[model samples]
Target: MIDYTKWDEYYDGGFADEEPINNFNEEYDERSELEKLEYGGQKTNVTAKQIMQETGTTAISEKFLYRNGVVIILLDYSKGIFDKWKNGRILHCLGDRTYTTQQNTNGLSIIDRTLFNADSIDKIIVRAFWKDETKKYRLVNGLLVLSKEKPYTIEENGKYRWVFPLSLMSKYNFQMPEKYSYFLDIKSVKEAALINADKEDGVRLTTLNKLARFSSSKNDIHYKRTPQKKIKYTSVQEKIERSSKIAENALILADFKCEINNDHFTFIRKNQNVPYTEAHHLVPLAYSDLFNYSLDVEENIISLCSTCHNQIHYGKDSESLIKKLYANRKELLKEAGIVLSEQELLEMYNNS
Candidate 1:
């Protein structure tokens, strides 16, 4: 077992000079030589269940589902997580059954005990299973954030079963896929790359897209650029623009809704035979030069109706509007490795 307490040390400079303790057999391992990954951090083959069990969290019912390495915890108690949802945040506990320190053998809450000993279990998966139906979700920062004005719910047991808000899911594209394994595991950037490029894993597109973006953002890659014999400086500035493919995909994913206000396009374009909402890049394309990663991906783009769209770029209170939109997209942008703070983004616009 890995001593996760020292994860930060290993994650930094400590493991750079060391070799992996275990080796995969050549014939049995199907991965090519290049695909064989070397980690500059501690690794263990331990499963998520084993990790959870070690922390004194066990399966209360078979409803606890594990798929592809992701564990889905179902909160069925009367005063479950639903009670903790407040002020746009859910106070998520580590274990299903809440107990006092005296009741628990470890003399600490499940989260306290686990986090005291280990780093953390990066993502938390939750879902609903009732009346022969299931609904799924992965927490946004392991907590649900409600919209300020809209109190949305699909009441179950006279309360909301869908603890995570639908607007959030739509904004972040967290809709549960029709067919998904209880477990989700993507170990390396290569795996993430493969998943992102794959087209046939039913409901894989959105889920894998998110996973891939998160994975790619965290991993290091060797960037190669072709050599240019000479460089020229031009007085004319190139137009900072989003890729047509990315814009088109963003519009399609949004289903023509104005993400900023949750309003629909008032009119349909005759030629396209579809509602028309312009794609607005959350991190504006004009600032493209400041970022290393592509700023033209779907995650960075939002669909808006003509009114909201025009107001965003021109209204006197556009800064406030931009800040509001930034709040909606901050998490998504962070997942994709864009880190421009609200103030920094505002400054760019103000200076311009």
Candidate 2:
């Protein structure tokens, strides 16, 4: 399991282990610790040329730290973008304490922006400047749930914005990957982020547009919807049954693997080898047309990793709920090993 607390907030190292080595003074060397994290046990540097070739994004020349390990992120950026950086620490004192990391580029230095792709790159170092906020962490099922939900209303620029304490911080001295999962909720084009606008929205819907650039996903989502109604069913029972067919059929096509509830994705850190992945739906039956008797189909469904799934439904998107779905329709069909058509979906079928 990845030590998210160490990366997300200040590190106290959980009740002072026996070894208790104080290496804060020592420089962060990523290569040295690979042995403890992975099976192969070797930390390697990612090249800029390789990143550009695979990601199809450009980067300006600049140097930054990743996971305390050496990472290459190329992005065109101006200077002094990370000015609002506030130093913070996560004190595990008695039980769970409170903390939040924010990411808003005064202006992202290209490489700083995270790009949409497959898999989570754990070896990245970022500096997290924090301010004292009222929210903290809640441990559920041995997982640390940030106090992002119960946000207190705040006035930034003469408007109300729910300021979340949690956001992306600079990855300067990335810790070695222990037996844990890592997630990069945010990233940049290359070494730097694309923008530095703090406070996603200031008191108006217009300002919300500014935040659109930050929606970088780790992988393209995948999900399918059930075929349309074919039968002339009219009774309430018929409607319920019809809806169920659509939702169920859609899920059947995706192999019932809730992408929004599973891993972000899989991809080779280096090489052409692809990774394993499944599909997830954005619109869950709990909130959507998924009914006690029928399928719930409204306009809100998406495919996502377990983490993004939790984030999308649990949080409010200001005016609407940000939904996700599969990015590739053909891939979804191929996975299901069957073909469907818009016409077949809409018309009820019976023995000819």
Candidate 3:
């Protein structure tokens, strides 16, 4: 069993490092590589019931094992599951068995009750894994989001299943440890998921203030460069998640002063002893899909004092403040693959 307390050790960087075993003896084994990885070399297929037993969970669901505050789901990459809904969002479907009637209420009810009740599971951590070309089950990606929508039944080919739509709050990559087991320890897995989520600024901003200081000292803010685009997910409300790191970097680059006017003084933060400034996306993340590139870059972020921040958001003269910020960042935005005419930009804010 892997010691998930030392979860940092389990991450093997990414799947790119693993090489496919093309010369492996396939004639001896009729099972595909994916099946082998999923079953951990077992001749017979492993059932979710078996996995639940191994994990020591009493959860009724065969698809997901819910314990504590986390939701662990096993995804099959070969099937190309996770249906893509309109606006580029992905939908994860519950098992094929339908459970609408009271007598049939089993696993789905447990999931619905746990997810909707606020006091129950506040954190929904998705530990996503996939079978790689190396015939190994690699922990590829993860997602952290709140469940706002209820599961509804969908029918196809005379068969019915529950479909749950999740908005992408945060998406992250995972790395496996050198020594690992196919059967995950629920306690350890939960700890590891939380740790990984924190690293990506996906779960919570617990380390945002600490990271801001470190980034300010180590990173050069003058050199304008675009960061790797984050994977976009569809949500019912069409909201986009922003990176806390990018916003922190923007604040650091601005020397923790208001961009509207540096002379506008604010109280120093007790923890960091720096002027407390908030980060704002000049081009809102909601309209990210309209552009070809990502809108969550540092150049698009602006630092502002709390008073000025509120003024820009709530004050009547927001247009003046917007104009000033746009003029200053027009060139920088162009460099970062975000090009918008001043008039076009104003219309966005005005419509909002």
Best by TM-score: 3
Q: Who is ahead in TM-score, 1 or 2?
A: 1
Q: Model 3, range 1-352, lDDT digits (tens) per residue?
A: 3232221232332123334334222421322322211111101123445444544545545345666555545545445444332222223445435554523335645555443332222354444333322233444233423234555657645645566554323223332321233332222224444344334432213445444453355256553665336555475122223366667777888888899999998887757767888778787655565566777788998988878878876799888999999999988887887766665566666555
Cα TM-score per model: 0.34, 0.18, 0.38
Residue 324: error of model 1 in Å? 1.9
Model 2 scores a TM of: 0.18
Q: What value does the lDDT take at residue 3 in candidate 3?
A: 30
Candidate 1 per-residue C-alpha lDDT over 189-210 given as tens digits, one digit per residue, 9 for 90 to 100: 2433333322222222233223
Q: Compared to the true structure, candidate 3 yields what TM-score?
A: 0.38
> In model 1, how large is the Cα lDDT of residue 122?
37
Off by over 4 Å in 2: 1-232, 264-311, 317-352
For model 2, residues 1-352, the per-residue Cα lDDT tens digits are 3333232232322322223223422322332332221111112123434333433434333332232222232211133222221122111111111123223322332223322110122542222211122111111111111121222334344533232222222222332222111121112122221121111111111221222121223243323344332344567445444443333333333433444443445433122122222122222222112122211332222223344434543444411223123233423432332232322211111100
Total residue pair clashes for candidate 2 = 70
